[model samples]
Target: MANVNDKYAIRMMKADDYEQAFVLWNGLEGLGLSEADSPERIARFLQRNEGLSFVCEYEGSLIGTIMAGHDSRRGFLYHLGVATAHRGQGIAPLLVNEALSALLREGIDKCHLFVMEHNEAGQRFWSANGWEKRDGILLYSRGLESRGLE
Candidate 1:
């Protein structure tokens, strides 16, 4: 909740928020967005993880966002970003706290997030916020072809 006199508010993110959130994320450095972030995909994500994602609004404009979801065991967070002008105003953490709190309410006990190897600022932010970095863990990925495994 924002103070009555403040110009900012925090709330759960809705599907309609995708456009604004995409613009904010695309403009931010160290954020790696791809086709996976398409509007349809984001909308689907919000539906599957309802009430777990959040956004921050300031003066009627979106200034921050955090997307969260879970696999019935561990929660994962993504796309956390704050407008450049809104940095240092504690908006990022507020968005994060909102997502984390929602995850907790869903009975998620542990959480994880990824930072690009080159994103120094992002790494620092997570470290400063009490998130531990896991060492010796490798992440692997594979892309499925449209007609594979038929």
Candidate 2:
């Protein structure tokens, strides 16, 4: 693993980054996610909603990624993952800041993300970054498999 400054930089993703981004995406714990994920799904998602994905590159290779989207209700954060070798170096916050900047510029006042209920590390990271837990709102998911999207 390379030093953080020497190895990684964050930037808006390009069309050609889909394959590399997919590799990073597959490594995440939860992201509609699995290591066997197909690039086609990622491509299709980005094509439908461009400017919602960003990648972090290390030594010219994709090592991290974040996906964000918004509706009338609130902005959603997704796929905010850093590669195993790139953890603990403040990369994720940069990616989140980039996404939040875009959303803020678009007039989004409230943004929300879901971490697995058991993920204490995730909770701590978000809290340290100034994200507070919404007191009463529960996140309920309708499984894609139940809807046959799996």
Candidate 3:
């Protein structure tokens, strides 16, 4: 697939694109992908929050992706990535805006995303896009079974 003009098309991330998307995620540094990021889980997410996640394709190849979903309380973003060759081409913001638009259509106003401290590249990407890093904030997690939140 040769998109010599650096133009890419954005679309909803379908189950069929999981393999390509997963490979793209693996190639990017500092994305905390896990077993929960498997094809089945992603399919379930897209099913539950239709139109809230997107992938950018260049000449039929998945080159960028952003995952967004809301629990009717707050929206969360995850695993946004752009191929190295396409980094400076403004693909990431396009993908993000698409997802944010979908979330807003659902009446969501506040959205949040997690970025690793050491991920300077990812941090810069978010910062450049107008995201603020909140001080005095920390995140904690645990298995549902362990926490009885299941």
Which one wins on lDDT?
1
Q: Evaluated with TM-score, which candidate comes out highest?
A: 1
Q: For residues 38-144, what per-residue lDDT tens digits would candidate 1 score against the true structure?
A: 99999999999999999889888988899999999999999999999988888888888888989999999999999999999999999999999999999998777
**Residues 1-150, model 3: lDDT tens digits:** 213255688888888889999999999998888879988999999899888889889888999999999999889999899999988888888888888988999999999999977899999889988999988988987766566665
Model 3: residues with Cα > 4 Å off, grouped in runs: 1-6, 145-150
Q: Put down candidate 2 lDDT per residue, 1-150, tens digits, no spaces.
A: 223486687877666787777777666664456432356766666665567667888888988887777885688887788887889888898889888887777788789887777767777888999999888887664545567665
Worst-scoring 10-residue span by lDDT in model 1:
1-10
Candidate 1 TM-score versus the reference? 0.95
**Considering lDDT, which of the candidate structures 2 and 3 is the better prediction for this target?**
3
Regions of candidate 2 where Cα sits further than 4 Å from its true position: 1-6, 29-38, 143-150
Rank list by TM-score? 1, 3, 2
**By TM-score, is 1 or 2 better?**
1
- The lDDT of model 1 is 0.91
lDDT of each: 0.91, 0.75, 0.87
